[model samples]
Target: MRLSKLFKNAPTTNVTGLCFDSRKVQPGNVYFCLPGMTHDGHEFIKQAVEKGAICIVHSKELKPEEMPVGAIYIRVADTVDAMNQAARIFYSKPSDKMLMYGITGTNGKSTIANVIRNIRNKKEPTGYIGTIAIEYGNVRLQPDLTTPDALFLQEKLSEMVRHGMKACALEVSSHGLAQRRVDGINFDVAIFTNLTYDHLDYHGTMKSYFEAKSLLFSERVKPTGKSILNIDDACFEKLQRISQAPVITYGIEHECDYRAINVQILPKQSKFDLVYQGKTYPVVTNLVATYNVYNLLAAIAALHETDMDLDVILEACKNLPQVDGRLEQIDMGQPFHVIVDFAHTPDGMKKMFQFGRQIAQTHKLISVFGSAGKRDVAKRKVFGELADQYCDYIILTEDDPRDEDPAVIADQIEEGIESSNHVFIEDRYEAIRQAIESANPGDCVLLLGKGDEPYIYRENGRAPYKGDNVIAKECISKYCRHINEAVDDVNEDESFIEE
Candidate 1:
């Protein structure tokens, strides 16, 4: 790829690759000086040139004395937009050659994206990009963002194309869309799970957040593509008005194209009567709760829009594997139940508690959670209040405190607790150990927020974590006898969710 070909009004120097990080630059690479909230990429241009960057794309003006001898400098008004263009052409518009599914919402993005990738993967090679990882075929990499920047997204899509993937499902975040991180890719099918109160700190207001999510259906979808939406959500009418593509509606509370009625949530599975086109079919899925019914419907509707056989899709849906870190269970022959979940938002926590209360029934429900620092400080106390309402006991601790003091965050959450049953423990490990150690038989321990994430972010930096589920297992091992892995007949890896 030549600089002149990749960009207008540029030199004709040949470019080998595109990069944003100066440390990762290779010879002949076009290094993009992307701006960030904390650091400016322009400050690293010297290092980029030193590491053999041929073309420098920047938004800020630089002195001629600082420019490398042979490096070509091209100034743009927005380097993010410039990077998106360079990536699209450099990656040869990879998304255009394959099917693309985009899912955006406050919650259930990961679950729905995984569902799409799983269903498509059964027919042909499929890839996924979301909260979990960037995966297709034999490759899997932990993601830095729920939806990565445009450059990484395009690069991964191109890699998927080269890996012989027939389709890809992406979890598009509000931040990603607002930052123009998904500029060039066109979505074949765009799905909106639902919008709720989250990310208000960065977005400033609910209206701003909703508008950011609406961009997917309005601008990113292909002109001929479909928009799969949740008609039951409060923002349904507003989203429908802004969506440019054709809409396929799904809901539980309202009449829609694809609706799940007569829903039943058992401990291990969810049963619902699927209503579509004036016909009804009994649907049984491994997922549970009313919220998951929405996720299942969104995934099925997206697949059905792709012209897949409804019966075949339903059959696949029935046996779908459990989503990692979501409602994840830690069952090591413990007398009581221990569940780990990634519920961080007010809506998500409410749903988790509602489900937990249902599962506990007459049994005690114990909740262990913490609020993240430097984010929507208003919600910290709300989390405590919700837990106080539904939980018999509460253990509040640290959750990605960032730069704020963990003790301060704990105090903020304690302000909402009217009950005398809650305690604040700053150390997450000790908190989990105490909660599990104190629980009696028939009690359910609900671990919230972290999910299966392997690291804990704090004021200093990110510290290595063994994940909530793994830590729960360690705590359980202290009170219970372990099943020998040497026994072939008894598999200790069994889970309540996967059962």
Candidate 2:
């Protein structure tokens, strides 16, 4: 493609590709000089030029002599915005070619995106891009961000279109939206799960965090498209007010367009009657928890807005696969139960514990968890408090203590605990082993944080740390003995709330 065709301003240069990292620059590729938190891309202009970059798009000013004499240089006010626009045009505006839905919130973005993909994939070819993995037909790759950069995103969407994917579900994070990663992609449906205290290290305030999430419904979703929101969320009113698309509300607490009534959260399943447009449909899913119910409803509402059949949605919801690292069970022919989850935030931990307690019933509830270092220190105390309230025995350990002392992180968490039932273990593997070893028959061991992540990040580097799921199974097989007895189910009288 020619640079003149992609940009409004003319530059008679042949563009072979687009790139931001100079290390990946190739001949005839247009290198975008995007500024970062630490290093400036402008500093790498010489390297990019030396690597045969034919065109350069930059936000920072450079002297005439600094640039390669024959290379094309286009100055823009914001290089990120220019990159997004160029990427969209270069990819032939692929987001407009398919039905695209975006999900945003503090939690449940991955879960909801997975649920929607499962539902849509039953009828037509579908793609999902989120925290866990990116999937469309035979294309599967680990995503670096919940929402990838504009260039990578446009290229992937174009690939999906070529592969005959009918729709795509994207997990839009606050940082992604704030950084203008999804600037030019048009969403056919936008779903807001909920907002809570999280990512304060970057956003700094609850209002700013909410504003970042609000950009999806306000700017990305087409005006004629639909907005599916959880009416029970405190930020629902603000999101609804700012949303340009028509609203479709879903919730279990308050009345809404699609509501889950007569809900039953069991030990391994959730049964609910979905009420929409004066009709009720029974929904039985492998996902257990009130929050999972909300995720299911959000998926159904988003799909229904796209003119999909309600019966098809319900059938697909009933048979949906378990999401990776989301309250996933690890059963190695043992009498007791073990669960692995990615509940890093306070709200996420609280929800995990609520569901744990309900399913535990008369059994002992053992929790193994730790907070991430150098991020959201205030939540450390709250996590300790919640653990104190819920778990029968708490085992505090390391959780990606990047550039911070793991012992200091544990000490901060211990500050809020009034009970002496918990113990601090620096080694995550030892903590998991001890928790699993001490559990008796029918007891539940809950492993929190670091879900399916393959490495433990610390000191500006990552070490080979096996994911919680793999470690849990390995520990169970090593220590726990197989029993002929089965783990007892939860009591019928117990109830769960998304506290």
Q: Choose the strongest candidate by lDDT.
A: 2
Screening candidate 1 with a backbone cut-off below 3 angstroms (N, C-alpha, C), the clashing residue pairs are none
Of the candidates shown, which would achieve the greatest TM-score relative to the real structure? 2
Q: List model 1 lDDT by residue over 1-499, tens digit each.
A: 8898888888888898999989899999998988888988999888999999998988888998768776889989988888888899999999998899999999999999998889888788889999988999999998889999788889899999999998999999999999988988889999998888899999999999999999999999987999999998998998788888899999988899999888888766788899999999999988877788899899999999897889988999887877778887677876677888999999999999988887776778998999898899999989988988899989989999999988888888889889738888988988999888877666779999999888889878888988898899998998555423255433233323311
Candidate 2: clashing residue pairs, number: 0
State the local distance difference test value for candidate 1.
Answer: 0.88
| TM-score, candidate number 1 | 0.93
Which residue window of length 10 is worst by lDDT in model 2?
A: 490-499
Q: Please give the CA lDDT of all the candidate structures.
A: 0.88, 0.88
Structure candidate 2, residue pairs in collision: none
